[model samples]
Target: MHMTVCLVLAWILIYLCVMKGIKSSGKVMYITATFPYVVTTAFLVRSSTLEGAMDGLYYMISPDLNRLFDPEVWLDAATQIFFSMGLGFGGLIAFGSYNELKNNCVKDTVYLSIANLLTSLYTAIVVFCVIGFMGHQTYMDCLDNDYKTLMTLYPHKYGSLEELKTSIKLDEYIFWMEHQFHHSEFPLLSNASRYCNYKDIIASSAQGTGLAFVVFTEAILQFPFPPLWAVLFFLMLLMLGLGSMFGTLEGVITSLNDSHVITVKKPVLTAVLCGTACVIGLLFTTRAGQYWVSLFDHFAGSYALMCIAFFEIIAVIYVYGYRRFLNDLEFMTTERPGKYWTITWRFVSPVIMLILFFSSIIKSFSHHPVYSAYDPITTAQVDTAYPAWALFVALMLVSLALAPTPFIYFVRKFKIWKIEGDIPAASKCLGSTPSTTYMLKSEPSFNRMVESTASELQTIGMNGPSTNGSARNSENDRKGNGSNRHPPKRN
Candidate 1:
């Protein structure tokens, strides 16, 4: 129920942002993009001091060094780079379009990419450290354990530095860690198992076929808080999530509006669409709601994103031509874009995206190992004919395939709206008069003839003869000396 509420509220926030201009929405995102980094840093520093945290870090890195040999690993890495950097998404293009032409966008992109990578590294360090402290082999294994048991395994320090130092030990800690991994079944484990078993029962008991409230009830126990930090983290997530969703929903809405299928006022449409989503989200209080959310998240979130990214890469680099695209890039950076960038944009990124897309497809076909504690006696009922997960994946693909239909129709009927029946004034004025603002067909300002003419004219008649007393006396002497000019002087 809480998850449903969060998702709905998140969607509503995005819708609100769409009603307003995206430029106005970005101030909130600047904080959202940085909050996770801060939290991860604090956690990393704290976890590194824990007794078994090193063990967790070791296991995380130990995942077959040979996995690097597999092409799939390279593909996965590429996908992560693309997804984390928000590449191949029109969001970057749209945001870049809004940015002032003079802004140094290449530097900003470089900085943002590095920041994202550093944050991911920090998060991995913290998570691995927590795993080490708990002596777990993998994250999924830890998740399977009782949440309370995992919480207690952490070395919480409340004393002076010396006391805290004394609490850290090799032998005693190893003994406890061994016992944790080998012997005890956590008391809460049984309770959690019961909750999972009761999922269907709880859903049936709800007003309709809704989500089990037990999941939401469990999550409230997991809120990590230093009241202020909690507030900051939650608010930051809200902003980040809203920013992403707003960008996506805006695309969807704009596409619809352009198609002329939706003619309502922008604000009104925004409110109605968002409000309807909220009301529909209330259905998440049932078993079906949980099922559907999981489906949408897994399929749309994973596979659909892959498809969209690949398409975006092809469209921009190949279809649009990287040479022409370089013109747009020049406005964003101080340095002249080099041959290396052209090569990467035209060839490398697309190849990477294609590789990742194929890997995802192959992985999807492979069987996922599923285990369950409950196998009912007697005639066992397969609650679902196929895994509910398949349903979700199918729905995701269907949704994506349907996304382009409106665009096709919109392109076909684009001429239906003709606000100006006559030619625009600017077009009419094009040949009729010379525009003061335009310098079309103007001569080159630099000219040798004009420059020489100006220099020659600067001294005017001064070069011909001096008019000063000395020059006048010299001229009279020349005539009196009776040279060729003596006859003229006599007159």
Candidate 2:
């Protein structure tokens, strides 16, 4: 019930924000977009002062140039770029469609792309700082706990606490302890013993939501005013999530409206769409929600995104004709696109996307879907693989986004063939086919009449009237100039 209420409220908020289309969302975005950055900046400033923060920053920016050659690194980088920019998703296209024809889309794209990358880097800095703090805290906890144990166990060897502390070399002591207590009967002792090593503390940190909620929250609790920082951190996350949801919902609404799939008032359509999404989202709120979310994240989010992107590039550059697209851009912008844009669109983007798409497919098939399952008692990841059937279902989920492209393409082609048989020649290039010749041929008489009328009008204009008739002829021509040009041909 709590989940349902949250879901409904979320949809309601989204509906309210975008019910009036881009106009409403555009106003709301001014706040939603800028506020997160402010929050992120605050977090970054606050986190930088924490103990061991520089270690995190070093870990993040220490570049191994050799990693560039690794396909896995490239794949990860490409995935981050795609998702961060919301490129493969229909949301960016839907948002852009609302722009005026004269709007400088090139400028907007360049600015937004740069902003997105910078924002990602900034967020990473904040995240790793928090992680570094966590690492530091964990290391201290392990150090103190192990130090107490050492004092308790070897009090006789060292005469007094000060003497033992002065005599012990911390690093060598930790190494000796870890080797000594490697398989202690007490689980807590064993775990604490392991953490005495700095590498173990670093290894314990997680990624994704675990890092956000678990690790960061843990770091927040160690701060001067825990509650204040906690609230601020959570608020930042909520705003970020809401901003993303707004764009995603807007994409669905815009697509539906453009396709004429739901012919209703905007508010009514918004309600229906949001309500439907909320209902579907209920699945993720269930007990096994994490599993389902992970499944979707793997198959639908990652794999399908790349596939959709690949096809989108192909359809635009190859199917729609890149040169014609550029011409259309020229018409709108009053300037031709540069060779850089043309080359990237025509070749570079498509080839790289195609490679990524196939690589993802190969990777998906090669490895079984195995998510880190946490043990409730230990809060440690268990080595448990998802069932085969669940992976199969995930594959089906991937097809949900991908299956429509080819299906819609064939459907459109069939409709064209049905309406205009033998009109569009097979050899004729897409978007470059001459005006339907078959339609023109079928109305030869009307065409001839129109041609004759145009010729007569031209002759009248060329052959100057007699001096007496000149004024009256010119007056008639002035009154009927538009009609004389090219009247609509009747069947």
Give the best candidate by lDDT. 2
TM-score of candidate 2 on Cα atoms, chains taken together: 0.79
Tens-place lDDT digits, model 2, residues 335-359 = 8899999999888987887777676
Q: Deviation in angstroms for 297 in model 2?
A: 0.8
Q: Write the per-residue lDDT of candidate 1 for residues 241-299, one digit (tens) a residue.
A: 66665655555544343333565665677677778767766766575665556455445
10 residues in a row with least lDDT, candidate 2:
424-433
Query: By summed lDDT, which 10 consecutive residues of candidate 1 come out lowest?
Result: 464-473
Candidate 2 regions with alpha-carbon error over 4 angstroms: 64-73, 159-163, 169-192, 376-378, 416-491
State which candidate has the highest TM-score.
2
lDDT of each: 0.48, 0.67
- In angstroms, give how far residue 307 of model 2 lies from its true place: 1.2
Instruction: Please provide TM-scores, in order, for all candidate models, with all chains considered together.
Output: 0.57, 0.79
